[model samples]
Target: MYQLSEVESNYRRLFKDFLRNSYISGLKPLLLHSPVQYAKALWLAFLAVIVVWTHIVVVNLTLEYIDQPTEIHMAPNLVHVSNSPFPAVSVCRSNMINRGLMNNYAFKIYQHQTQYEGTFANDSRYPPLDLERLTDRLMLLTNFFLNTDGKHLDIDELGQLHNLLTSYYNGSVYSVHDILRELTPDCGDLVVRGIIYGMPVNTSQLFLKRATSSGTCCIFNYRRPSYSQSPGQRELDDAEMAALPQVVFESNSILNGIQFVLQDTHQDDYTLSFLTNTAFRLQIFPQEDYATVQSNKHGEILVDHNTIVEVPIQPKFFDSSAAVRGVTPKVRRCYFPEEGRKLLNQSYYSLDECILLCRINSMLQHCGCASSPMAGTALNVSYCTLLDLPCLMKWRGIWNGFNEYPYVEQYEEGAEDASSMSQCPLCLPNCDGVNFEITSNVAPLRKAFNATGYAHGLLKSLNNDRPLSIIKLFFKLRFAQSTQMAMVGDWVVLLNRFGGILSLMYGFSIISYIEIFYYLTGKWFVLYYRECHKQKNDSNKTELDSSSLHWNE
Candidate 1:
C-alpha cells in the first residue's frame, strides 16, 4: 500500500509538470492558480472546451461540404472568337409522309389483301388482313418510324398484317427505312431554295438525308456520318470536309446565316390530324452531335406557312477547370467525352447521344430489336416493324424512365427485378459541350419578301395559298457564355480551413502538435524508464546495508 501511494503521487507530479510546460493556452493557467483562484481556472478551462468543440463541429461540416467536390458556375469572363462554328439545322415537314405516295401504298395493300382473302379465309395459321381497318393499320405501321406514342394494334393482328404484307411482296417485306423514304417528300421538293451569307446555295448539295424521330429529315451543316454508314467511317476525307456547308458571320445580322423556303403539300385523306401541321418542325443543334427527336424536342420551333421566321441563337459552352479535372469523373458528377465513350462503348459522347443509346440499348434488351427511328444500324440490329410495336409499346414506361433520368442506376442483364431494371445510371453529362438557346421572330413571308425585294418570281410561281414556310437561322451575339466546373472544397482548401479552425480555437500549429506527441510518447517513456532504474538502485542499496548489519551482529 505504501508503494502504491508513492506511484500515484509520482503520476500526479508528472501530470502537473506536463500541465505547466504544455503549449496549450488554457492548460497552464489551470495548474498555476491557487486554491482561492480555483473557480477562475475552471471557468477558463470550460471556455476552452467550448471553443474546441465548436472547432470540431466546424471542421466536420467543412469536410462534409468538400466531399461533394464540384460545383458549376459561370466563367469570370465571356469568350469571344473571330468566328464561331455554325449550328446544324434540321427541317422536317410536320406531315412526314407524302400524301400521294401514302394513298398509292394504301391502295396496293388493300388490293393485295383482297387477293389473299379467299386463299387464307379458312387457314387458322394465316389470318386475313382487315380491309376496313387498313387505314388504322397503315397509321400503326408508320407510327413506329415517327417515334410517337400512339394506340397500337394487337400482337396477333400485327402479325397477321405482317404476314399479309410479306405474302403481297412475294416473301420480301419492306423495311421501315425503305417505306419512309418512298413515302416521305423528296428533299428537292421540300427545300425550295437555300441561301447562306446572301449567296444562293444549291439545296441538293447543302442538305443531307438524316434519320430523326419524326422520320427522315434534311439537315444542313451536319458533319457526322449518317447512322446507316459504319461508325468507323465517321472521319471525313479532305474533299468531304471542304464540301461541308458552313457560314461565317462578321456581325450578328439576320442576313448573315442560312435561309430556306420549305413547302408542304399533303392531301387531307392521307394526313393524320395529329401528325400533320401547317408548319415546319425546325431543330437546331451543335454540329458534332446527333440530332434526335427526343433530345432536340426542346429546340424544335414552328415556322408557319406564308410566314418568315427568324431564329436567333445564343450559344453557351461548358468547360471543366483544372482543379475539377483533378478529381475522378464520378466525384465530379460528369464525364469527359473520352471517358463517357469508354464507359458507354460508343464512338462519340454527349448527353443526348448517351441517352439515345441508352434507350436503344434498353429496347434491344427488352424487345430484341430497336425501332426504326432509333440508331442501331451500325450494330446490325434488326429494326422493329409493325409486328414488334406491341412489345415496344409494352415497355414504353421504361423507355420514358430512361429519357427522364439517364443517370439512374444500371442493372445487370436479364435481371428479374423489374423495379431495378429501368435505370441507366452510366449516362452522365459531358464535362464540356455547347448548347444553343434559340428564339424566333415571325412576319408575313410576302410582306418580308416584298420589303426586301427578293424571291418575287419564286413566290409568284408557287401557290400563295399552299402551305409554305421561310426560315432564317443566325447568331444573336458574337460572344458565347462559358460555364465552368470548379472544385468547391478541394484537399488544399480543406487543409487550410482545418488549420485555421485549429489555430482559432487553441492557438495551435504544426509544431504544437509535434510537441504534444513528443511529450506523450518519447519524453514520457524515457522518464518512466529512468524512474524504474532509480527505484532498482535504491532497493539494491538497502539490501546491501541490511547484509552489512547482519554481518556486524
Candidate 2:
C-alpha cells in the first residue's frame, strides 16, 4: 500500500510540473487555479474548443494535401520572345474522296459485278449487286476510312456489306487505306497555292502527308515524324530539327500569316453532300507535337467556299518546375516528356497521342486488330479490314469511353469502378507543351478581292467561278501566357501549415511539442525502470533476511 501511494504521488508531481511549465496558452492558468474556481473551468472549456477546432482544421488540411498535392496557376509574367516558332497547320478536306475518281471506280466495279453475274449465272457464292446500291455501299466503306460524322450502319448491315465486298473484290480483303489514298484528291490538287509571310511557297514540296481521323491531310510546319513511320525510325536528325520553320513576330494581318487557297473537288457529289461539309477543315497546333483528328477536334475551323477566314492565335506554354516534377505523376497530374516516353514507349508523348494509343491498345486486345485510321501499324498490329467493321462497331462504346486523363470530378466519380472501366490513368497531360488559342473572323472572298491594296495576285491565277476557300493562320500577340505547375502541399509545406495552426491555438513551438512528448513517453519509461529496480532491491533484501534467519536457527 505504501509503495502504491508513493507511485501515485510521483505521477501527480510529474503531471503538475508539466502543466505549470507547458507553453500551451490556457494550461498554466488552469493549473494555477482550484478546480472549483470559475476561471479554471472557463480556461478548461476554452482549451477544449481550441483543441477541437485545431484538430478539425489540421485534419482538413491533411486530407487536402493527400487529395490534391499540386496546383496549376498562371505565371506572374508573360514570356516575350523575338521569334516564336510557327504552329503546324493541318488542312483536311471535308469531302475526303474525289467525286470524279469515286464515280469512275464505282462504274468499273459495277461493270465487273455484271460480268461476274453473267459468267456465274447460277453460282450462289457471287451475289448480284445493284449499281446504285453498290455505289452507296462503296461510299459507306470509304466513310469508315475517313472521319465523316453521323453515317453509322448497324452491325448486321456492316457485316453483310463486308461479306459482299469481300466476295466481289477478287475474293480478297480490300485495303481501305490504300483505296482512300487512291481516291482522295492529291494535296497538290486540293491545296492550289500556299504562302507564308507574304512569300509564295510550293504547295507540293512544302506540305507533308499525315494520316488523321479525317483520312490523309496535308500538314505544314509539322516537325514530328509521320504516324506511318516505324517506331525505330521515328527520331529526327539534327539537320531536320535545325531546319524547322520559324517566323518572326509580324503584324496580325492576313498577308503576314500562313495562307492557303483550298479547292473542294468533291463539292458537286450530292450522294455524300449531306454527310460532309463543303468546306476545308483546318487544325492548328504546336509544330513539335503530332496532330490527330481526336486531339485537334475541338480546335478545327471550317472555311466555306468563297470565304476568307482569318485565324489569329495566341500561344500559351505550360511547364512544370523541378519541385513539381519531384512529386509522383499521380500527385502532379502530369507527365514529363521523358517520363511519358519511358512509360508509353513512344518517341514523344501528348495527351491526345496517349489517348489515341490507349484506344488502339484496347481495340487490339478486343478485336485482334486496329482500325487503319489509327497508329496500330507502328506496333506491328494488323489493320482492321471491312470484315472487322462489325466487331469494331460493337465495342464503340468501350472505345469512346476510354478516357486517359480525366478531370478531378470525373476521377472521383469513377474511382469506385475505375478498375472495371477502360481508363488509362498513366496517360496524364504533358508537363511541358504549347497550346494555341485561336479566334477566327470570316469575310467574303469577293469582298476581300474587291477591296483596294490586295496585291497578292491570287485572283490572276484562279478562275472566279470555281469555289475557292482561303485560310490564314498567324500570331496576334508577341507575348504568350505561361501556366506552371507548383508544389502546394509538399511535406515541408504541410508541416509548416500544421505548425502554424498549433502555434495559433496553443502558443506551442517545436520545442514545446518535443517537451510534451518527452514527458508523456520518455519520462514514463524512466519511471518504470526506477520502479522495477526498487522492487528488485526489496526482493533481494527479503531473500537475504530469510537466509540470515535460517543460519541463526
The best candidate by TM-score is 2
Q: How would you encode candidate 2's per-residue C-alpha lDDT over 1-553 as one tens digit per residue?
A: 9888878877987888888877777777756647464877777788898888988998999988887788778999987623456677888776656677778777787777666564432135445667676666677765454333334665555555565555566666565655665666667877888788778877866676555655667777777643443333334322343464554555555666778888767347434532345777787776755565444323767788889898988777889888887788887777898998988786777776777677678778988887765552356677787667656665553444333223222334434334212366667778887777888999987733543424557644576445788887777876878888877657788989889989987886789879989998998778877887988999999999999999999
lDDT per residue (tens digit) for residues 364-441 in model 1: 898998876556235567677677787777666455542322224443345433332235566667788766788999
lDDT of each structure? Answer: 0.67, 0.68
Model 1 residue 299 CA deviation in Å: 3.2
Error of 2 at 271 (Å): 3.3
List TM-scores for all candidates, in order. Answer: 0.76, 0.77
The ten-residue window of minimal lDDT in model 2 covers 401-410
